[model samples]
Target: MDVIVIETPQLGDRSYLVHDGAVALVIDPQRDTDRVDAAAREAGVVITHVAETHLHNDYVTGGYDLARAHGAKYLVNAADPVKFDREPVTDGQVIQIGNFSVTVVATPGHTHTHLSYIASDGTTEAVFSGGSLLFGSVGRTDLVAASDTVGLTHDQYASARRLVHEAEHDAELFPTHGFGSFCSSGPATGAGSSTMGEQLTANHALTDADEEHFVRDLIANLTAYPSYYAHMAPANAQGPGPANLQVPESLDAAELTRRLADGEWVVDLRNRVAFSSNHLQGAVSFEYGNGSNFTTYLGWVLPWSDKLTLVGEHADVEDAIRDLSRIGIDSPDAAIGTEPHAVAPDAPVASYPRVGWEGLLEGRAADDVLLDTRRTDEYAASHLLGAVNVPLHEILSRTDEIPAGKVWVHCGSGYRAGVAASLLQRTGRDVVHVDANFDEAATAGVSMAELTV
Candidate 1:
């Protein structure tokens, strides 16, 4: 069997194209389906089946659209309350695709109705575990709801162990979430695909401890996930439409001002430095180049119903739109490519002061608040002395907690810090972005503290 792995690097999810010469099956596809289609065409095989492991909570699935386009059977769990038409397959159901046989294994925990597909073409075998059994860790069980976390954690452990025990020892294991994905309960020890044997030996969920201990550790380790995740389940349930990849029209200066005046979101997609150096008044700086978490923050802070406009170069705007679509932000109302100065000539441009780690330590005062925008676990592991932890995801709601005075913002690298600084500046708070390696704090002779509890 030819197994093609398609990865969405930004979200750290993988989709699989498994085929046996004549026909193929796509598992857990992302919003953009063109790449999968292209792969199928190149392989000279028709996409006969599309299967979803679960109702995704991180990004929109392209399974519905891809299946409709190819006239393929869209397979989903019968337990999922999805609105669209699909073939609801249950546990032990075997689907024959040309010379390949795919057996659906019910694996809950990632989602209550999650399924892992085992495909074999007589010679070789592979399992598309989706979010169930990852490279070295299991999928996080907390995304569903707080009440379900403990129960789901138990299910997750059982599911991981079951996959390892049931699947052939040498069978290739391909999971949807792992490689730096926040969807994982913990960090994967290795990268890319791993054999069932390797996972049985290395995966923490499979080998770490008993169910109770695994659940406890899993719950404790699940850091804050993206706020965008809240909308994904509902959107996926209703079957999100195909993404509109077309570049939006460029909004003139007057139109941009009108939108901003109406309280519409105008996200600036430039680098943090450029965005902070000079940007149109009222434009929120959500630096596109910051990191893969660009869409996560945007989806979290901005209302989904708001008429959104993106300001950046052609390339950046296009890339942002694609990334945004993964989280169901399909199309922006407009994209502005005109120079900011020309677009809003008379408007006052806003900028924030940037400082190195040493500079922040030396210049910080009693009233200055140090805001750490990293993940809660990252903050718990180690952080600067007296730095208040308000992760970038929680910044919007906790702005009231920020004391009056300059806010010195810093994250692991400098990306999140830059984004936080712009957000603070937008709120009229005097902010200093510590645009330096946070690891340099100790080396720079700054006081650092590690949380004991």
Candidate 2:
């Protein structure tokens, strides 16, 4: 038996194709099924089955298309009875293809209809545990309000422990998610596969721990999930289905600008840090896989007629388009202009009002309001002599709280200050983002201290 794992970057998703002789089975395919088809054909294998571990909330699923295109049988759980066309996959139910037999195990928790499939060829052993047990963390239990999460998590933990206890000690575990994938929090920089024994020994969540500690730890590390996942479950059940992700042709800048001006959504496919620093004024920054989380957000925020224009870094056009296509977006047009010239060649360095010891006397001479946007704990650690706190996220929520007449906003390295400055500017408040070069001001005997919000 041969097993191949395809890792979709940005989203940290993995798809697998396992075959024996000339028959193959695909597991948790992404939106684009051409690649899977190509691989199967190259290996002289006919794809006979497509299995979805569960209705996914991350990227779009390709089960329907893969099955239809290859005339393969689609397998899914009867418990969920998702509206998609699939031969129901139930607990202990086994399917044979070539020499391999896969047995279904109902593992619920992350979502109500999750599954874990154990596959063996009577020689090598493995389990395509969809979202159940990732390398370090279990799938997020909060994907939905399924039963009592606390109880569900407990049940999940117990079920996972069963996998650990039952699967062959040397069975290679192949999951549909990797490190960067939201499905797990394991370091995204490591190897993709691990033996079940390794997870049993090293996985923090699976270690010997009481149920309460495990549940608490599970909830603590989860970041705010992508804002768009709320709609994926229903869409997957209804089978909006997948599309062929063809490579997109590049567009010139003028075409890009035209599209945007014509109300097309411009999705900036760049890293978060790069995107945060500089980008086209109205372009929405969503790095590939991560962008899908915000796709629904973009759909609602922007009109449907808005065509998507891609802005990629380092000439990563194809990579950007491929990532976008995974979320049901297909064949977007590229910008129809030259590379963007330096807008602010010598963009003015951000600046703001400064204070000094002489300035302190000057402040005493003329009362000046010192503003800070660090966390409250940071503020308690240290603060400017007379600065007031206004945490950044809440700034817009409580605009009335920021003093009207005069306020100087400063954060660690001026990044937060710039964000705050933009927010304040929108609200018609006079504010300047401070440069991080406060040391120069302090060197000139300026009185500087930390401030928290």
Candidate 3:
């Protein structure tokens, strides 16, 4: 049996296709089943089964649709509160597909009903640890609820321990999260490939013998996740239809301007530099140029019910729609063109100055408010002296707290600052995007401090 990995880097998750040359089983597919179907075809295997480890809190799953399309048996946990029909599998139940034998293991924590599948074909074994035991960290326990966090963290610890004891130490590890997904409890080891043995040595879930210590550190370090996460599980439980990848109706400059005026999320998909140079007066900067984070940030900050319009090069606009669809934001309207003014002729033009830490040092007056848009933990670690900290994720809710001044916002790598600056700029604040890497700011002798708490 050969295991093919289908990585959704945009969402920092991976789905697996295990096949015995003729038949295959797909695990935890994203909303776009086309990619899974293409993989099966490319491998010359018929999809005999599709399984979901849990009702995902991240991307909407394509498992149900993919199963229906291929006439494959869909496997979901019997305990999941899902409305869709599937071959409900329970812990310890074994299923056969072509040359592979899959044994389901109850590993709850990512969610209460989560399951990890161990697939073996004679000599080789592979564990499909969907958001459970990731590379060096486990999936975050907070997605369920604030009240459930403690219980779930304990469950997560136990689950990781169970996997290490049950699965072979040499079993190849393939987790669906921890590669930059917010679902991760913390930073992963960043290794490309790992085995259960490696996780046993390096994963905190395994190395920390004291479960209480593990839980405390994990909970305290838990940072703010995307606001859009609230809508995903419900959508998955109801079983969303196939993703709508079809391009939305193209709007002329006048219609686009009207949409912007009406307070729709008209996102600009140029680089932050280009967007800082000039943009549609009301358009939000969400640059789609290599925007692996396009869906994450855009989905996080935009009001969930707001109609979205993408403005960029034709290809970039199309790609942004595809990324948005994975997160269940479907069929957003499009305005294709490179230049903001060119795309929407009647739209007012806007520009903001972007600079490095040195430029900030030279020009910043005593009255200028330096805004640190990194996370709270990041601010605690090290930040510009006297900079106001409103983490990028909390920027929407805490906007009123930031003092009125010339806001010079900066983040670890300037991405979050770019997004924050645009939101502030849209609110009629005098803003400057600090487009420099924070690592450089240190060597450049910028004043920095760490929060005492």
Candidate 4:
């Protein structure tokens, strides 16, 4: 038996294709079916089955559509009230494919209906613990509901224990999240892969016998996830069509200017520094990078109601559209150009100065407001003195909370600072982006409000 792992680094998730040289089963695929289809063809196998551990809260799942295309049995949890038709598999159900058999184990706490599957091909057994049992942790328990957090956390603890007990002694573990995914309840080890034996000693849920301690620590460590996550499961439930990776209609300078005036979203996909140096007025800088946290941030800050447009070099624009598609933002209008001024000729040009923490240490005016654009927990742990904490996700809604002064924006990393800088710049604020790592601030002699770990 060969289990091929498909990594989607941008979202910090993985999908698996398990085959015995002829028929295959896919688990937790992303919205892009092409990647899954390609993996199957290359493996020289036909996709006989597809299973979703749960309706995902991050990216749209390709399972429903992928199953339909291949005429495969779409195995979703029997309890989930999904809109689409599928082969409903319940807990302890064994599915015999071409050769191997898959045993479903009820492992709730990623979601109420979450399940983990153990597959064995006569000799080697592999456990597909989607979001339940991660590399060194488990999936976050807060996603279900605000009130369900405490209850679900306890459930998460039980789920992890159940997975280990049910699976084989030396079964190789494959989790859908926790490479860098926010779905990880605690700090994952960031290892590529692990076995049940390694995780038995290393994992928090397994090592620590006290369930209450595990629940408290897991909930306390759980941070904010993307606002876009709210839309994913709903989109996934409806069983959406395949990703629209086609290049969008190219917008000229005049049309682009008109779109900006209409208050449509016009994303500037350049280097954050290059974007801050110069960009079209009202264009938001969401600089596309490798691993392109492109969807995570863009999907968070922007409204679903707005018409989205992309402005960048041809390749970057193409890549950005594909990145956005997995998150359900498809076929955005785009303008391909290296020169921002030329792309939107009629639009006013805007620029903001980006400096390091040293710049603030060297010369910070008395009237300047130091804006810390990190999550609340991050700010509370440690932050600069007199820094007003307004998270990046809350920037649009909480603009009025910002004090009247020259603003110096900073985050744990400069990427968010650059994002805040552009939004603040568009609002006509005299903003200076402190594009430096937060670790440099203390060493650079910046006064801290608190240093409690």
Model 1 CA deviation exceeding 4 Å by range: 261-263
Per-residue C-alpha lDDT of model 4 across residues 1-453, encoded as one tens digit per residue: 899999988888999999999999999998888898999999999999999998898888999989999999999999998898999999999999888999999999989999999999889899999989999899998998999999888888998888889887799999999977778878799998899988999999999899889888988888999888888888888887888888866787899999888777889999898988888888889989855477788888888657888998989988788778888888898998978777887788888888997888876798899999999988988899999999998999999999998899999879989988889887888999999989889898898886654
Q: How does each model score on lDDT? A: 0.84, 0.66, 0.89, 0.89
RMSD of each: 1.7, 7.0, 1.3, 1.3
Residue pairs that clash (backbone atoms under 3 angstroms), model 1: none
- On residues 1-453, what C-alpha lDDT tens digit does candidate 3 reach at each position? 888999888988899999999999999999998998999999999999999988998888888888888889999999888888889899999998888899999999999999999999978899999989999999999999899999999999999999988889999998988777899886587677899999988999999999999999999989888888999999988878888887766789899999888877889888999999998887888877574387898888888888888888888888888889999898889988888768888788999999998889888889999999988877888888888999887887899999988999999988889989999998889999998888889788798775576
Regarding TM-score, does 1 or 4 come out ahead?
4
Pairs in clash, predicted candidate 4 = none
Residue 307 displacement in candidate 4 (angstroms): 1.3
**Model 1 C-alpha lDDT versus the unseen true structure:** 0.84
Give the Å error, residue 327, model 3: 0.8
| TM per prediction | 0.96, 0.71, 0.97, 0.97
lDDT of 2: 0.66
**TM-score attained by model 1:** 0.96
Query: Candidate 2: misplaced stretches above 4 Å?
Result: 185-191, 244-265, 268-281, 284-308, 311-318, 329-334, 338-453
